[model samples]
Target: MAQKLQTGTSKTTRYAIWAILILTVLSTVALYASMFLSQDNNYKEAKVQQDNYKKYQEATEEYNKKADKQAKELSAKYYNSFKEFRKTPSAFKASDVKELEKKDLKVGDGEEITDKTTEFYAYYIGWKPDGSVFDGSFNKDELKLPLAVKKNNRGWGVIDGWSEGIQGMKVGGVRELTIPADKAYGSNGSPNQQDSAKSIAPDTPLKFIIMLIPKFEEIPQPNYKDYGF
Candidate 1:
């Protein structure tokens, strides 16, 4: 074992192997880091989309509730009279407007009305078959509405049904009148949409609660020009 130069691995070979190992480790680390970042980004995007979908569902629910409420209010017109209607009549039906039907809810002690009185100092609520109010005179002080028939053989101020229906009613008496379309605006229906979202349809039946007995007076003359009478 004299001094023999032991040359194990050369420096170049050792350096090359070390470099390859270092490069492989760096590449593996880079790949794992990139995969983690990508997964994180995907998770964040999915969460945001889910939140957006949840918000949309909530908004749609709210809108549906609001719409249901509005629809209920709109349809409430059919039964509103149950609050104070003393004698709710039977379900009304559409019939030919050739006759008038009258029923007394309460008879008064006052004298019966006369045809000489062209107008009556009374108050009334004109309700439709569905219990929706189409018109009313009770809002004003003792309303002086013209009678269906005048003193002379004059034209009817109101509908013919009302004229015939009020025949035997006395002052302070309440009467319910069922009027036909012919006695009202006729088959053409009223052009004035004065009720709740319902224009009086043609051939529609009408009901009325009329009360008599007040100071006799006259309303101001209506301008035909203004009302297109």
Candidate 2:
């Protein structure tokens, strides 16, 4: 009877040991599963962020390209119109010699001017050959823009006709400048001037009646004079 009781106690001890081992294995498997799931979530989030960033960069590039293209087109159109206006003869004739007479204006011949750069202040009425005024900036209250001729970098500022016609005037002089269509707006009129109906066509001839106000300061002669004999 003593031996049988001893054998039963041994069997109970072995069963308890097996239960403890199984519980430890299950706990380890659960911990590993949770860690793997967390890592996967983090990887997916990082991929999404990278994709969004790429799309934003592409959109910015496209916007800049479109803006640059529009600016180039506007500049080209403006220059082309100017070229066409230069070719018309009607742009050269004075519209009002009588008005010029009332002001006691004396226009100097193209030859008497010595300074390469001519400066003047003048009121102007610009019109198409058809007697349509497209742009006129003549007003006593308005500030006149100084125009210079033959200056190395300055001559390019004025329109082609103003540069060519203004050379004859002296300081405190006034005259009407009639620019031919080829030298004026040509087929494309002033881009800023809106028609009364808001439907003016491009490349229309431009005309102007300019008065010479004062001669611009002459460009300084280089010191090459000191080197001369």
TM-score of each: 0.48, 0.36
Please, what is the whole-model Cα lDDT of each candidate in the order they appear?
Answer: 0.63, 0.48
Q: Write model 1 residue lDDT over 143-227, tens digit each, in one string.
A: 3232223445674467777777877788767888888777866788775745443467777778887776444333333243332
For TM-score, the strongest prediction is: 1
lDDT of 2 by residue, 1-229 (tens): 5654443457778888888888889988888988888898899877766666666556556655664454344334333323233223243333432121122145533333334543344434556655555554322333223333334554546666666665555543444555555565456645544446322345444445554443433333324223221
TM-score of 1: 0.48
Q: Any idea what lDDT model 2 has?
A: 0.48
Could you give me the TM-score of model 2 versus the true structure?
0.36
Clashes of each: 1, 24
**In model 1, which regions exceed 4 Å deviation?**
1-91, 95-98, 138-153, 193-198, 216-229
The C-alpha stretches of model 2 lying farther than 4 A from their native spots are 1-105, 108-115, 139-154, 193-203, 215-229
Best by lDDT: 1
lDDT of 2 at 89: 23
